[model samples]
Target: MNKIYILLGTNLGDRFQQLNLARKQLETHVGAIIEASSIYETAAWGVEDQPAFLNQVVLVTSELQPLACLNLTQHIEQELGRIRFKKWGERVIDIDLLYFNQEIIDLPSLQIPHPYIAERRFTLEPLVEIAPGYIHPVYKKNNVYLLDKCTDDLPVKKISDDEPYRH
Candidate 1:
C-alpha cells in the first residue's frame, strides 16, 4: 500500500461534519486512514475576507496512484457540495493531497508536496502532530522542523486539547 498524507479543511455549512464526511469518503475511495491529527481552526488564507477554516491532517494507506487519488478527492469534494467560484474561495470542504509517499510530482492537474507546505501553519501544525519525523522529499526536512520554520502569520488554533482526529 502507498502511504498518503491528506489535509482537510472546511469553512461552510457544518464544518466539523463536512470534515468527518470527507474522512469517510477518503476511506471508502482512497484507502483506510491509519492516523489523523486534532482539528485546528485558522483564519482564511489567500482571501482574508472569508470565514475561518477548520483543518486537520490524516495519514492513510492506499493502493491508488497519485492522479487517481486526486480524482477521488475532487469527486468527494463535489459530492460534498464544493463549487469552485474562485481561487482559494470559500467552500464546504477543501481536501488537499499533501504528500504521497515522499514522491515529488508537478502535473497540470495536481502537484505533490502541496506547493505550500512550508508556508502554511495550518498545514504544518496538524501534520507535525501525527508525523513529525516523516521527511519531505524535496526540502529534506521533517514535519517538526518544517512547522518550526513556518512563517505564515495566520493563526492556527487547536479546537480542543482532548479531541482526537477520528470521529
Candidate 2:
C-alpha cells in the first residue's frame, strides 16, 4: 500500500457536511484512512473575497498510483458539486493530494508534495497535527519545521479537537 496525504477544504453549502461526505467518498474510492487532523477554519487563500474554509489533512493508505489518485480526487470533487468557475474560485469541495509516500512527482497535471504546502498555514497546521515528522520530498523539512517557518500570516484556527478517524 502507498501512503498518501490528502488535504480537504470546503467553503460552500454546509462546509462540515461537505467534508464528511468527501471523507466517505475517499474511503470508498481512494483507500483506508489511517489518520486525520482536526478541522481548522481559515480565511480564504488566494481569493480573499469568499467564505472562510474548513480544512483537514488525512493520511491514507492506497493501492492507486499517483496519477490515479489525482484522478480519483478530481472525480470526488466533481461528484461532490465542484465547478471550476475560476482559478482559486469558491468551491463546495476541494481535495488536494499533498504527498504520495514522500515521492517527488512532476507531471503537467499533478505535483506531489504540494507546491503550496509550506506556504499555506491552513495546510501546514493540520498537517503538523498528524504528520509532523513526515519529511517533504523536495524541501527536506518536517511538517512542524515547515509550519514554524511558514510566513503566510493567515490565521489557521482549529475549530474541532476530535480524535483522528480510523476504520
Candidate 3:
C-alpha cells in the first residue's frame, strides 16, 4: 500500500458535516484511513473575504497511484458540492493530495509534497500532529521543522468533542 497524505478543508455550509462526508468519500474511493488529524478552525487563505475554514489532514494507505488519487479526490470534491470560481475560493469541500509516500512529482496537473505545503499553517499544523517526523522530499525537513518556519500567522484551533459527518 502507498501512503498518502490528504488535506481537507471546508468554509461553506455545515463545514463540519462537509468534512465528515469528505472523509467518508475518501474511504470509499481512496483507501482505508490510517490516521486523521483533529479538526482545526482557521482563517481563510488566498481569498480572505470569505468565512473561516475547518481543516484537517488525513493519512491513508492505498494501492492507487498519485494521478489516480488526484482524480478520485477531485471527484469527491465535486460530489460534495465544490464549484470552482477563484483560486482558493470558498467552497463546500476542498480536498488536496498533500503528499504520496516520499515521491517528488511535478507535472502539469499535479505536484506531490504539495507545492504549498510549507507555506500554510492550516496544512502544516494538522500534518505535524499526525506525521511530525515525516521529511519533505524537496525541503529535506520534517513536518515539525516546517511548521516552525511557516510564516502564515493563521490561528488553528483544534475542536474537541466534535465528530465528522458519517455519510
Predicted structure with the largest TM-score when compared to the true one: 2
Tens-digit lDDT string for candidate 2 (100-119): 99799998999987989999
Once fitted onto the true fold, the runs of candidate 1 whose alpha carbons sit more than 4 angstroms away are none
Report the C-alpha lDDT of model 1 over 10-86, residue by residue, as the tens digit.
99999989999999999999999999999999999999899999999999899999999999999999999999999
TM-score for model 1? 0.96
| lDDT by residue for model 3 (1-167), tens | 99999999999999978988998899999998878888999999888999999999989889999999999999999998999999998899999999899999999999998999999999999899889999999999999999999999978888842653222
Whole-model Cα lDDT of every candidate shown, in order: 0.93, 0.93, 0.91
TM-score of 3: 0.95
Worst ten in a row by lDDT for model 2: 158-167
